[model samples]
Target: MRVGGSEYQFTGTQSHPYWFGWESMTTENPSVVLQWKSEGTGEQHQQNYPVILQVGGGLLHIWYISPGEVWNKVGTAPFSARAWHKVELGIFARPDTTGWFQVYVDGQLVADARNARTWDDRGNKPRWGVYDSKIATADQTHWINGLKLGTSRADVD
Candidate 1:
């Protein structure tokens, strides 16, 4: 589903945390469940989304793509199949080196990345669903629920 508008747009150095519930029944590798992409055009226009939450090797992986077109695996957490999991993500949207990315699973901090470029020229927009994977041969099915966006951990957690 598409999730973005003027109300959700990021301004100068703004950051936000989001929470969502996910359950997957398939062990499909590289099945992207969420992504933050820049819809505006400019450098790296053809590059992949700046941020992505996907399942690979039966684990939850957080990926960050830099402005230089480098895909970095920032964090990962063990994921159990056939069970609902609460996932919270916080991103400090900055094109410079001061940005950060964080991930929490089941109320436990899993990944915390600091002092990195986490955004592009234009702000990233959120997209949720089962993104198709080229290397994945089997069909995948997943469920997403209880999505929330807030300024603090108490608001989304």
Candidate 2:
């Protein structure tokens, strides 16, 4: 899914709660599950995504990429394969130190980043699905369902 255009783009101090179910068949390293991408052009294209949620080495990780092209591993959570798992994510996208990101797995708070920078230039839009990495060694399959995005936890939970 691609969340761009005026209707879905977000920036500044905002609270977005997202809920989804994910099931992976391969323990592929750096299999990106979700991303918040900057919509800027030219030089900004070289900058990494504002945020990335991915599975690396059978574990879920949250990566925060700064405007200066720094990759920060903010948090990680346990991931179980071959079964659908509930994921709830909340992001406070801000360019300053007041920003934060939180992740809940199976109704438990697994990972969080507080007082961190979570925004980039020109705002961002979300994308979902399994991306990156080469899983050619085995037949790889990923299932994503019930994707919901809302202003509060109640709306998506």
Candidate 3:
């Protein structure tokens, strides 16, 4: 995967995360695995978007936009390069502070966030591939298998 170049492998609505189980097998790379991009105006005030899963610098980064037009890191874990890892993101979406998000690696709960303002008026949807990155020339090769999005955790398990 290249840092700047990308191809969205799958696209789905924000609600898909709630009733669905997300799973992917990937080798370590400093690139984005998935992105949930909200509507943006391309202007300075509206450049922010929603959730994204990125791995880089030996860390897995789960970032989501907050109310202040900023990207906030909600979850993170150490990366294991050259090995296949199963990653899962389970979302409990609520407009209020009651909403939560969870991250699992190899079926082990690594990060759980509560009272998070996960979405805004723009809404969210998934776009798999390389997302926007910090480096223009950073590139990587990753293998993915068993990528799934479905209505139950068992679907991915």
Candidate 4:
């Protein structure tokens, strides 16, 4: 069985911060996303723990409960979910298309850099965890939702 997704464009410039929840979908990476949808299409985990998704520079910005860490984390997918990974903001140098990118897990700042690139061979609404042949079939899935592009906290803060 399969499921279709949604099409929503945020109404704002680089001055609005978008946010979503872990109903069951997040971006593949946390370093380079700008929007989201609550569509968990892909693989199956031990169970769904839900996650926050984002994009920056060109990496997926994942904000969720790392499977095996002390503190939650925000990093690229294809990673484990059980460690308190440390993040360093200002990782980039000039802010991404969304103005600037920040990383936070379990309510903490990890990395915040600047870059002008995002995950878009198709546009702003990029797809993550899309059954990559590079990985494996059993590992095909994107696990987060609620996307926010063209905006961030700094813009409103």
Q: Which candidate is the best by lDDT?
A: 1
lDDT of 3 by residue, 1-157 (tens): 1223764333233455453334444444577887655545555323244556788877778876665767778778776777677777766554456666677877777777777655544555555666555666656555566666554566666
Cα lDDT over the full model 3: 0.61
Whole-model Cα lDDT of every candidate shown, in order:
0.69, 0.68, 0.61, 0.33
Compose the digit string of candidate 1's lDDT tens values, residues 1-157: 3356444655436545343333334344568888877766665454347778888777988888776578788888888666678887777766677877778888788878787666666666667777857765666676767777776667676
User: Which parts of model 3 have CA positions greater than 4 angstroms off?
Assistant: 1-29, 40-47
Give the runs in model 4 whose Cα sits over 4 Å from its true position: 1-6, 11-14, 21-98, 115-123, 126-128, 131-133, 137-142, 145-157
Give per-candidate clash totals: 0, 0, 1, 47
Ranking by TM-score: 1, 2, 3, 4
TM-score of each: 0.79, 0.77, 0.69, 0.36
lDDT of 1 at 42: 64
lDDT of 1 at 105: 84
Candidate 2 lDDT by residue in tens digits, 43-80? 76544576888886768888877767788887787776
- Give the per-residue lDDT digits (tens) of candidate 4, residues 116-143: 2322222233233443234342333344
**RMSD of each candidate?**
3.3, 3.5, 6.0, 12.7
Clashing pairs in 1: none
